[model samples]
Target chain A: MDKESYIFNKFKNSLNGDDGAVVGKCVYSKDLFVEGVHFRREWMSLTQIATKSMLVNISDAIAMNAVPKYALLGVSLPKDISVGEIDELTNGFLKIAREYGVQIIGGDTISDEKIVISITIISKTKNPIYRKGASNGDLLAFTGNLGDVKKEFEILENGGKISNDSKFYIPNLKDKFFYKVAKFINAAMDISDGLSKDLSRLLKVNSLGFKPLLKLSKDELCSGEEYEILFAFKPKFKDKILKIACKTNTKITIFGQCVELDENTKFINKCKEHHF
Target chain B: MDKESYIFNKFKNSLNGDDGAVVGKCVYSKDLFVEGVHFRREWMSLTQIATKSMLVNISDAIAMNAVPKYALLGVSLPKDISVGEIDELTNGFLKIAREYGVQIIGGDTISDEKIVISITIISKTKNPIYRKGASNGDLLAFTGNLGDVKKEFEILENGGKISNDSKFYIPNLKDKFFYKVAKFINAAMDISDGLSKDLSRLLKVNSLGFKPLLKLSKDELCSGEEYEILFAFKPKFKDKILKIACKTNTKITIFGQCVELDENTKFINKCKEHHF
Candidate 1:
């Protein structure tokens, strides 16, 4: 047998130990955080860098609506970096892992010209909410509002201070209320790549789209990392979602609705123009 | 209360899906393959790149004694690359996933300066083999012979010609096994930066070291990319392990024992020391 086939066969057999306990099929995901490309070290702290690195997957796992269990991370850094720096990053990582109840079990470390972080998060759910599960009549909604991150980016880009102006960058306090809202979500993914791009991805995956009642500006369109979930659900749950959001003092927004497509198509903003 | 603690806790709880079922406690690992830095695009085919990238973790998972399950992969490529070339790498990754029963459920992609593939693999096992598990009294045994990969590197470094015409680099065959041997070991790891450097990591993690029963030379000490498992077990299992290797048709090398100390207690090789 070929190498891949041989490996999978062994992996399959290995799952069945002598005992009755059997591990389930895990839906796995991996991502990279590169210096300058994925993030800038100066803009964020070692703690923020580590948190964002971990959070990237936390957002992804939430997107799938699959309960995440573990994270394996690998990092390559320059020789000059002190062991103290690495320890700080690990503290950040372990803090995140312990919070999510996921363990930082194992990983690899090597030397390279730049800092590169690779994170793998594994989660399993009996009924994993996939991008394919969106229905034609589903209403599209977002857990939080946008424009703030765009505004924050603008402030930082054009000498605006985020911390000094609180109620601006992250406006709403969506704590426990937002968690409750997540349960009712049919399909969810963060608006990591502004509304225009991620909206395209979320729709393309489901093969559905809608006419946006509202159009976002260029800044809103390309805001790189919003880190808020955009979900699609039946319109009936709208009120319940709002009520839950209200309970936790978080904001909720209804961006648009999941509409029927004549052909096997992708979700686009132009509703009447649902051309395959 | 601290920043790291806050992010991890929220992220963790979100991953568990408090409303219902949860996936918990997983092992996820990631490695970055940089062209030229990590691998030369000119030297390796896309398929080999893909396979090697995946194999790095396969060996790692094997070292940890975990059944590899999921992968979070990121490929930052040059914009000039063709879709077909990208597909070749993707197919290579998918092929390995199918083979290892690893689910490439999700990850990220971007355009960058060079082709940077940061892969994170997730795995689980009730008993994870850790570098810290080995004790001073344990006998250090290794599966598969070293010096083979060093031979390949030597060939490349010296105009791709081996001094010994008898040397080889074929995928399979008893005389030259270049692939990894990661199975049934107490605590294991791949030899990426030669035995001298990599062994130091295993020894450091556990605050342990070993001595040599048989004498060795410089050739045997600093062997690189020997992607085999260096494990320590009770001497009583030595004969049984030899039989196991025979049954598996794998090679075994009793490189040395886990010693007490040396010039550097982290790792002590009775073999020749490389002094600049």
Candidate 2:
């Protein structure tokens, strides 16, 4: 197991193992966007960094079929940060929060060596989705195209600049689409740690395997920070899901089907872990 | 204004300027504890660090007269963290969580240069005590003794070690007393950034000033991380508050009364800012 999993496993009883933890009608989730580890100042602008930070967290709530209502930001800023930069960052958070109708509540700020933003989004949902409800023979699918984020990350790592509208900077979450399709989905989560690794987690929790229906390349399977929805549903609702996708203007890919764990079937995770 | 206030002022419309923001019946708050900025690893154990982290956040909820029901922890660990250390940190969080009956819901973990914990507490209160609502002539008071945290912090800064029972290591919150006296409080907040600074904020937001009933030392006025309650109440409830304090075994210090802002009556904050 990776270091993140190892530490969280110690709190296994309290953890819901979902995109966000559900309490009553509320879904609570937090995400960290730290300098150096998550992104470099040279790669993205302050607004872009803050925007991605909020969107990545909002993705968790969307995956749980929750509408985010409130946010608490923990911003650890460097001592020498400029007021203009702070404005850019604050506007970045406010812009996304306004778009999603999330209220910026109270939070703490401190001085640190780098910009470490930890945000908590509290969302409300009537029927929250979990990662353990997928049954055998359930059809597995994902929203949006994958593998582009990996190519963009490789370009940035190689000292090449990508476009201003790169997915790495601005992630597009399917909040409206997910809200429409939530009732049809049995299990759901966001694909932040690539398709292969996240898919394995979704299946392992249900003690299931996968039977691939479409060929997927390593790039498609291993791209991180996709922020797309990965969900499972009964085959009977396939046409209804397609109709909803069309109505919501969301791209859907039916990649595989959930299967009983067998010696012949292997659901391997070839994606590299994001954190230690 | 300080940098923290300046940055948060950019989003003034969304901020409630309270210990925890109240949305409907739920209160949400987030706090950051960064190594080197908040504490040093050599001075405190991992368990102590984790315990303080949880207590400080819980104090926000308590000060708002809300019972902490759920928490989301954002932990950034050093790359070289050991499994045993992780266990200690998790246990420390769990121990405090169990004491307050808070559920450890979900959080994110990442790798960084030092341990940075950002915790978000989601609490429920039927009637939250805000930093506003104090009127002229209302009495101001604090719970527990003040000035020890500043001395302890100075000792630690000067390479002097303190005892395991230091208030800097484990903050004793007046949660029970606050819950019992919440109805009597006109305005309330925890003294995290020392008495002078935090009390000035409490009064300034209400368009009021202070009349010092008792002379306060620099140490008492400027100590940070006291995590004690600073509140305002009417003179009619003063005796009732004192009786509740006696019943709860809490030390109550009535320091001043809220006064109309005047040139002669100044609420000078001599406390040094905790963060840039």
Q: Which residue runs does candidate 1 get wrong by more than 4 Å?
A: A1-27, A66-69, A82-102, A123-127, A154-175, A209-222, A263-276, B1-27, B98-101, B124-127, B132-137, B158-185, B200-209, B258-276
lDDT by candidate, in order shown: 0.59, 0.91
Q: Write the per-residue lDDT of candidate 2 for residues A1-276, one digit (tens) a residue.
A: 478888778677645567899888999889999999889999998999999999999999999999998888899998899888889999999999999998887688888789999999989999999988999999999999999999999999999999989888988899888899899999989999999999999999888989999999998899999999999999999999999999999999999999999876658887677768
Per-residue alpha-carbon lDDT of candidate 2 for residues B115-217, written as tens digits (9 for 90 to 100) = 9999998899998999998999999999999999999998999999999999999999998889999999999999998999999888889989789899989
Proportion of the native interface contacts kept in model 2: 0.85
Interface RMSD of each: 12.0, 1.4
Model 1 chain A worst lDDT run, 10 consecutive residues: A13-22
What lDDT tens digits, residue by residue, belong to model 1 across residues B1-276? 123222233334332211111234454455667676656765567877787788775666566656777665667776566656766777788878888788764456666677778776666666555565667766776666667766676666666653332222222222112122223345566555567666666777667765767665565667755666667766666777777677778877776667665564446544343211
Q: What does fnat come to for each candidate? A: 0.32, 0.85
Candidate 2 clash pair list:
none
For model 2, the stretches where C-alpha displacement exceeds 4 angstroms are none
Chain B TM-score (model 2 vs. true structure): 0.98
What TM-score do all the candidates reach, one by one? 0.76, 0.98
lDDT of 2 at B53: 96
